[model samples]
Target: MTAAAACDTAALTAHLVARGLTASPAGVEIHPLAGGVSNDVVAVRAPGLDAVVKQALGRLRVAEEWLADPARLDTEGRALRLAGRIAPGSAPEVFDLSDGYLVIERAPDSWVPWKQQLLEGTADPAVAGRLGSVLGAYQRATADRDDVLREFGDVTAFGQLRVDPFHRTIAARHPDLAEAIGHTVDVMAASRVCLVHGDYTPKNVLVDPDGERLWVIDWEVAHVGDPTFDPAWTIGHLLLKTVHRPAAGAGFAAAGRAFLTAFTESIAGALPIDPAQLVRQTGCLLLARVDGKSPADYLTADERPRVRDLARRLLIDPPETITDAWELLA
Candidate 1:
């Protein structure tokens, strides 16, 4: 490895050795994995073990102010553990964790981020369907699992994560967004309950090179409450991504719709939420554009005309069908 790469790896290996994941003189080898906007992940090879070590830094390696979140790393271990329980195959076992570090089983280095595949025009929607199916199982299994899901209950404070930063901070700086976003407090208060992956976009998923199973990662903002948490998130990102890359986006949405439709059907009997509850959740998803902390900076100036237009129609005046809401994202 190069010196800069070593800079991100050796310190952690030493930390792990002290924690008993590896022996002090075991001749460990480390390979740093780089990509994504907010993490430092590395592959570690030791005499008795092979593992992927990851850490979340407070500031993004990139200079985007909206990407910064100091509290994110602390939520990693809990989210991964919960995800492993619900969909064991989707995540590697969590071998160890501390302050800002996470260690899990090492998968093939050939893993491709679902986003890059979509951009390159090769992502499979059927795999996304399986993702949706498994996520539905996760919700059903964990909904009342000894209140474990409920312990991570701060998702109700979504107005803070989803609303204030965009409205009070970023969108407030722009005159165009100012009027529509002004006094947006009441817009979020109603539907602020549910266990949501708060950042469940495609950028957070990885597909094994064979184009088979999927792995969903990055759960710093995950919490319990809404059934629409995962689906609405998937829908909105689908709309945004599709608008950006027409062909791949189209494929993603078709697969997403299939996944979500199946997921809803599977969990219909188990969801504690009613129509009013889901409607409220969908509305909360709409405000995600104007009031969300990170906002949707993933879109371009040309795309915002469409995204913002959809956010307003949906947030301010919603349609009856959840499918109708998806078109805004498209």
Candidate 2:
């Protein structure tokens, strides 16, 4: 079915019923969920199901005409199932996957997106640590697995959702940085070490109010690629938060540090993380958020230039370590 046609609530409800996922179409309630630009996400409440359904969009819901394969929904469902097996509770259970829709366990109402919590000036170091550990475990468990590499070899979704929108967009905007950005892109494309959560940002992580449970969601871009990509994507967001909320910079910086420490510690001896790649990727991400197709809404017009300048510095004179990069911001 066409992406536009699949977005129709009545059509979606019919599809669910046809797939036998819903017992009745009359009582099923599907409401759109906020904060997704690449897909139609809905909270589904029915007689026997409380789940979230995501339908991948061929063209993203952004000002730019960003396009991607709707088949990436298949990748996300597979990744969630694998993650559940590798690290139980880290990712939601996939209840169903058909057509371009993925139905998975819904997070409790008590759980809020980590991005919301971070934006509210609440930087919990423990949350960062937990994210780091869970991600590390995922990478470690899936690393060097030939079966996994075969299953997730396609980088089409990652390219469309991330590399094109962020790295390539930034490169085009800043001609001088194109060479460095191109090199980073080359390295990431060539590397096939482990499974990478291509969008490992705070927005994708859901946390309980009491900080007891953390669930990583949205694995549509998951692929077997560079290990640094996940950590870099994550730390880059924390840095952006620091810039957006300067008053809470110290707290954000601490969270970044804690995240890196826990991440490195968790993967120690299991997989080696390249400091240079991490630094370069982080720099690319920093620039991307400012100049990419989907710029961070929180960054002011004036703050964008500062971010661009810092990103350029990091790209040209790459940091020796993640801590050094954080220090530059500090």
Candidate 3:
């Protein structure tokens, strides 16, 4: 069945029952969840089941006509399973993966998305520190695993969802920087360092209200590629937030520094991270969000050019350290 047709709540309920994930469809509360731009997400609550079910959309919900393989769902499931094994509680428990649908444990109500908190101007350094530490551990644990390399070697989804939309799209728009952007693409394509969560923005990170636990969600674009992509993606979002809410820029910058320090310290001895590569990727991502298929909605019209100029400057004169990139906003 087509992805659009399969998004029906009734159809999804039936699929869950057939897959033995739910005992019955009766009294099951299936409500749609927001914050997703490429897939259908529903919160399923039944007599004894409380989970989030996701079905990948062949055509993403973007103004641009973007298409991706539904098989990315399988990759997400596999990534979640691996993350659970590598760092238990860092990712939701996958209850079932059938066809193109995935049902995973739904986080508690108190666990809010870090993006929401950031938008509300509550910049918590602890959130960044936790994410850095967890992601670093995952990458270190899964590093050099040939089996994982083979399983996630296909960068089709990552290319379609990330590289094509963000890096390539921006490169086409800014022809002068095409060489630099293309170079990063080629380097990322050739590198097989560790598991890269292609989309590691704040929106995908969930933090408990009490500030004790955290979970990283949305691994649809996960792959085995450049280790810097995840951290770069994350810091890029924080930079955008800094531009969007300048009043909270100082706090956001601090969070970025904390996250970078924690991440670098966590993987200090296990793997070597190139500071220049991280800043280069960060520059590419900063430009992508401002002038790519999916632009950041939070930035104002006047604010976009500021980001554009900063991105270009960074690309031309890349920083030697991640902290130096943060200092650009200062």
Best by lDDT: 2
lDDT of 3 by residue, 147-191 (tens): 998988888999999999999999999999999898888888878
lDDT per model vs. reference: 0.63, 0.89, 0.88
Candidate with the larger lDDT of 2 and 3: 2
- In candidate 1, how many Å is residue 241 off? 1.7
Residue 235's lDDT within candidate 1 is 64
Could you tell me the TM-score of candidate 1? 0.77
lDDT per residue (tens digit) for residues 1-330 in model 1:
778767656678778788888777468888766645567877788877788877765555533354445455556667788788877778667888785678887766788777777666654767677767767776777665547555676543343444454445534555554544443434333333444566666777778876677777777667665566566666666666666677675676677677676777656667554443344344444445534545565567787666656755654566775556556564
Report the Cα RMSD per candidate: 4.2, 2.2, 2.1
| Error of model 1, residue 286, in angstroms | 7.4
| Tens digit of per-residue lDDT, candidate 2, span 58-86 | 99988989999999999999999999998
> What's the ranking of the predictions by TM-score, best on top?
3, 2, 1
Sort by lDDT, best first: what order?
2, 3, 1
> Where does candidate 3 have its weakest 10-residue lDDT segment?
1-10
Q: Which portions of model 1 miss their true places by more than 4 Å?
A: 1-8, 60-74, 144-146, 155-194, 272-298, 325-330
Residue 15 displacement (Å), model 2: 2.2
In model 3, state the lDDT of residue 148. Answer: 91
- TM agreement with the true structure for every prediction: 0.77, 0.96, 0.96
